[model samples]
Target: MTTAYYTHADCKRHEMGSWHPESPERLQAIEDQLIASRINTLLDYREAPAALESDLARVHTADAIYRIRENCPSERSEYDHFPLDADTSLNAYTWRASLRAAGAAVAATDAVIDAEIENAFCAIRPPGHHATSKEAMGFCMFNNVAVAAKHALEVRGLQRVAIVDFDVHHGNGTEEIFNGDQRVLMVSFFQHPYYPYSGTEHPASNMVNVPVPAHSYGNVIRELVSERWLPALEAFKPEMIFISAGFDAHREDDMGQLGLVEADYAWITQQIMRVAKTHSHGRIVSCLEGGYNLSALARSVTAHVKILADLE
Candidate 1:
């Protein structure tokens, strides 16, 4: 089976702002590298479908959902109103793009569960994981990975799912959505005392929140995964694995102070795949989260995807 690649043009339309770091160029950079490396030919490509309201409702509250939609301005052409938070905003295309972002994860999950592909990578935007059950923050409108994890459990009849987030910022939102759910095991690390600044506090038992120091190198992250994440993940033995694949932790990206590179991303993907092979029958659905620097983000993502597609 081939690895499935999912994305859509709408994702590019959900522009935060020209000055914003999470620009549509991020997607273009990845696609360009995939083509340049000829890795695009090794995978199956599909347009991401819009996420159904019912699937979104499983993870996000009705109030949060309604607010995002109600806040979406219909009259705007080039730009839209600032949103509930300063960092995130709603353009005319944000609503549609957010749905597709969440939907891509759902579609990826479906493809993996159905054995249509060995694995899947969703190249979506309006990066989720920062948006909470109650509000959106940190350049996010919807919690995409959380929605997919919920779908795997509630819709697909899966008992356990693991979320692996290597984003530079803490996925406070994902942790909030799956706080009390024992069936979901989340192992992640982020730069501490940074934006949203909440991972250090008391987290839920099911959540393995590792707060790494600023400017840490790949060795530090590798140690965390081997010493901490692997044990928790192995014990969980999830039926499926989901990844919040963020590449901003790269040393070249000004978004965070972490000292990771493209090789680091591939290393983590390999580690996650090993766990999937042992327990989850090699089922994995990964979606984009952060990673702002265009060139570094592209290289890092291609590295992660190469490993996911076994082209590495």
Candidate 2:
């Protein structure tokens, strides 16, 4: 089985604004880099499906879903200014694009769980680690990774699932959704004193949050994951693994100051793959999160996915 790459054209249509860092060009940049690097030749590509309402309802409340739908613009001009938060906005196509992004995660989950693919990477946009159970914040509309974890447990009958978030910002939404749930173990690393800053304080028991200082190098991240994340993950013995794969932590990205390079992402991917191979039969599903600097994000993701595809 090969690595599955899932994306959709609708994802590019959901634009926050022309100036937003999470632009539609983000997807094009990654895809262009993958094509240029010959990484596209090593993977099986699939178009993402639109998420079913029932599937999204698994993680987000019905009211939240209804609010998003109600807020959707009827026409392109109607959504000149639809705001979820100060940073997050919605346009006419935002709802459909969000559904497709979330659906990519669900489909990737199904592929891994059914053994049709050893692993998968969702090259989707309007990234989803920050959207909580009811609120959409931090450029996220729905918790895509959270929905996949819930589906794996509720539908696939998986006893335990682990979510590893390597985003520059904390996955407060995902943590809020799965906190105290014994079946889920969440390991995350984010730059402290950053955007949506509330991860360092009281955290859930199942959450292993390691806040790295600004300008810290990849060695610090490697040490933290080795000491804190791996031990907890080993003890949890998750039946499946999910990755909230964000590449904004790269040194070239202006979003955060953690000094991670492409090789660092590749190393982390190998570590996660080691855990998946040992405990979960190599079932790993990775969904995109935050990655800004076009060249760095594309290069880092290529390094990350190449490892996931076992090309290196």
Candidate 3:
């Protein structure tokens, strides 16, 4: 039950602003809790490497990659920012950090496939689920999990893969990238009418998108997983599984209206693990996505990692 913990120092150096919710402190908070919970010692630590341009090409368009690289801000005393949108920005360190974020996912995928570890959790920032193939927005630079899924298929020669996104926001970027691709089966439950609101329309047959209303509780998510996600996953029998593991739905977090707690996250992880063990050889790679409230994010991540590590 070895679980690799993938992260990089560059992740903390990428910041939108002092007041932004997606601050660097989010990673530190998870680190503090893992120590407090004594779960840090039970895991294997790995530094995330930089992703190659070819890896980015698998999911992101060349124009998108060129935009991110060319728009990198030069070093300055006051630190300049290139705003991708109203809520997302790119600082000087963003290019390096974005590479690390995507790299962590790819490295974790390789590790799992090679059986270096049963699974891995990527503690990265500049959360990536919202970035589409042609653009970077919603605090995301590149679609990290998508790159990993593609790497698994193209490089590792996997026939099929499953991406499970539990983020509060709909993974419009992920859905957009893998929309008509039959090799990838993406299942997710996101708050409807939410930010980047776009998951409720006619999705591809390979997608199982369950859009729930705001204020939906943990029970609703559990039921959706049982009836929607599990059936598709079982039928697909993915060769590998990737999770856009966002904890913003925690009841204590104000980022979203969904009322999910730590125990609920644990239950969800258990279900994913069950399916992974049965179909995917217990191979899982989870990358960070969203979760604003520091305390809730830390505690929720601890719970989720505990299940992945088989600690509890």
- Identify the candidate with maximal TM-score: 3
Query: Candidate 2 at residue 76, lDDT?
Result: 46
Worst 10 residues of 1 by lDDT: 75-84
lDDT of 1: 0.91
Total clashing pairs in model 1: 0
lDDT of each: 0.91, 0.91, 0.95
In the predicted model 1, the residue pairs found to clash are none
Candidate 1 structure quality by residue, lDDT tens digits, 1-312:
589999999999888778989899999999999999899988899999999999889888899999888777784465766567777888888889999999999999998999999899999998999989888889999999999999999999999999999999999999988997999999999999898798878888999999999989999999999999999999999899999998999999999999999988999999999999999989999999999889999999899998988886
The global Cα lDDT (0 to 1) of model 3 is: 0.95
- TM per candidate comes to 0.98, 0.98, 0.99
Pairs that collide, model 3 = none
> How well is each residue in 1-312 modelled by candidate 2, as lDDT tens digits?
589999999999888888999999999998999999898988999999988999999999888898788887777484474888899988888889999999999999998888899999999977999988998899999999998899999999999999999998999999999988989999999999888796788887988999888998999999998999999988998899999999988999999988999999999999999999999999999999999999999999899999999888
lDDT of 3 by residue, 1-312 (tens): 899999999999999999999999999999999999998999999999999999999999999999999888886732788888999988899999999999999999999999999999999988899999999999999999999999999999999999999999999999999998999999999998999889999999988999999999999999999999999999999999999999999988998999999999999999999999999999999999999999999999999999999999
Evaluation by lDDT, superior candidate among 2 and 3: 3
After superposition, which runs of candidate 1 have C-alpha atoms over 4 Å from their true positions? none
Clashes of 3: 0
